[model samples]
Target: MAAGGSRPEPFVVSSVEKVHRVMSWLKEIFGSQSLPPFEKNSETFDLLYTLAEYSEERERDASVLIEDMKERAAKYDAEAEYLQSILTETFDLSPSVLSEEGSAHLKTLVDTAMILDTKDTSLASLFSAISDRSLELLAAETKNKELELNLLEVRNKLTATLALENQLRMDLKKAEKDLEVEEAKAHFRLQNLQFLKHKSEDISIRIKSAEEKLIAIGLQESLMHEPLMKLSQKLAEVQEETVQVKKKLECYFNLPTSLPLARVKIEEAKRELNALEEKVSMRIEEMTDDFLELERL
Candidate 1:
């Protein structure tokens, strides 16, 4: 079973070999210690195969980039040699014999020619003037950026101010509505106060007229209230006392009619007493006979 397990199918063996090659390549790129143990399965083999193909593609791209850089370097080297020859032949000075100041001046002139897209070193003065214009343009651009920033800040502040103004307007409207409601309530209350005042004045007028009429009839004002009230209280007290006296008189008048009923009740009580006395004598004679029989025994 171990031998059979160790041996895999032909396709699996081929896939395993391919995965091993990919693993070796990966180890070269990212050291063996960085990679995990290779898994022997169809899925793992497929993944390793795909990774190998992708790595080859990236390697090809890197080779092309390296070639391009090498070409550029070679071209730059040739240009440098040509420039050195020109300096040695035309100026009778090798690059090694040129002074630091002259070298710096030549480099600046070359840089300026490159910037202006021209090969004319004679236009150095024009390049200087153009450089000044570029400096001014850069300064203008920087100032423009600052102005844009300030404008943005101002716009943000204006937006906030507008929002606050809108909120204040809404609050003002709400306050106005509340004020109107309060004013309406106050007006209603004032009208009610005025109505009450008029009603009280009318009542006062009616009371004054009634008092005048009473005076014209020769009746004293004090007699209309306090004296009448006192008379009414006295009359109620006299009526209560009369009712008590009448009750006592009625009880005395009913006594003659109740006497015959009282005498008949007394006669019925005497007859009940005589019947009780005869029943007691009969119970005593029966008890004496029972006692004499017991003595004879």
Candidate 2:
């Protein structure tokens, strides 16, 4: 309507296109039949917008959770490595001759010498000192054997604790992967809902503009043009049908509304995991104490 310019094209709605395609396809497959109104289609777009926002928030929360788990996992991994290094440094867990065996051989030699020393008073005092030294060495050897056994017990407990920690780490990794998948799904759904809302707005505007044009033309002529009237009626029908189809499709593809449930479950899991981590920490501390005692011995 302006000089040297093209007139704006009539706004075509995607909802109308969707209805036309669905109706035509259905009609071809089956006979023409009346379809019921889908209430959700007539429902306000606010619901979709709200759901989109909720999904976005959930996605954000999941991302945060994933980051937190990664941080915790890294921390625990370092701690486990440190504990392992401490264990290796503190305990000499290699195969070697036991002190008891060597001490037994030394005791036999000392006993033979004691019998020989009884033949002369000159070696009597020297034999007494040797006897005392031999007894002291035997006592030290017995104490060393006990300490070795204790160290063995502590090492066994630490190994078991480390295994449990590794299992927890694996579980956390699986949970992280699951959260990532859920986040992707939520993001996809959010985009789809937003798109639908936008299409609905565009369709509504087009319907209003068409209706106004029809009304003006009919008023000016004091009678509706038959073809225009038919077209208007068809458009109205298409609009309604589109809404119903949209609702039905939405219902068919309903996204699972288990975000809150999942959150609750994840929180419960986190609490349990935290408790297990604390237990492992306590065990590590105990092992550290034992290692310190072994050093003193």
Best by TM-score: 1
TM-score for predicted model 2 compared with the true structure: 0.31
- Clash count, candidate 2: 0
What is the lDDT of every predicted structure here? 0.73, 0.63
Per-residue lDDT value at 74 in model 1: 90
Cα-based TM-score, every candidate: 0.39, 0.31
Q: Please state the error at residue 167 of candidate 2 in Å.
A: 2.4
Stretches of candidate 2 above 4 Å error?
Answer: 1-134, 217-297
Tens-digit per-residue lDDT, 1-297, candidate 1: 685577665754476578788778778878746876666778877787778879889999999999997997696678778878887889888857878998898788778666665434555656776887799899999999999999999999999999999999999999999999999999999999999999999998887887678768765554444455665586567556555655544544445645887556555554654554465556446546644643453
Candidate 2 on 1-297: residue-level lDDT in tens?
A: 568999788965465554555445445545767654434351333344344446668989999999997997696568656745665667742223327776586466546555545322235655786787789889999999999999999999999999999999999999999999999999999999999999999998887676568566543222224444664575567556555655544543444546776566556655655665575566556546644653453
List ranges where model 1 is wrong by over 4 Å: 1-22, 37-52, 109-297
Q: Locate the minimum summed-lDDT window of 10 residues in model 1.
A: 248-257
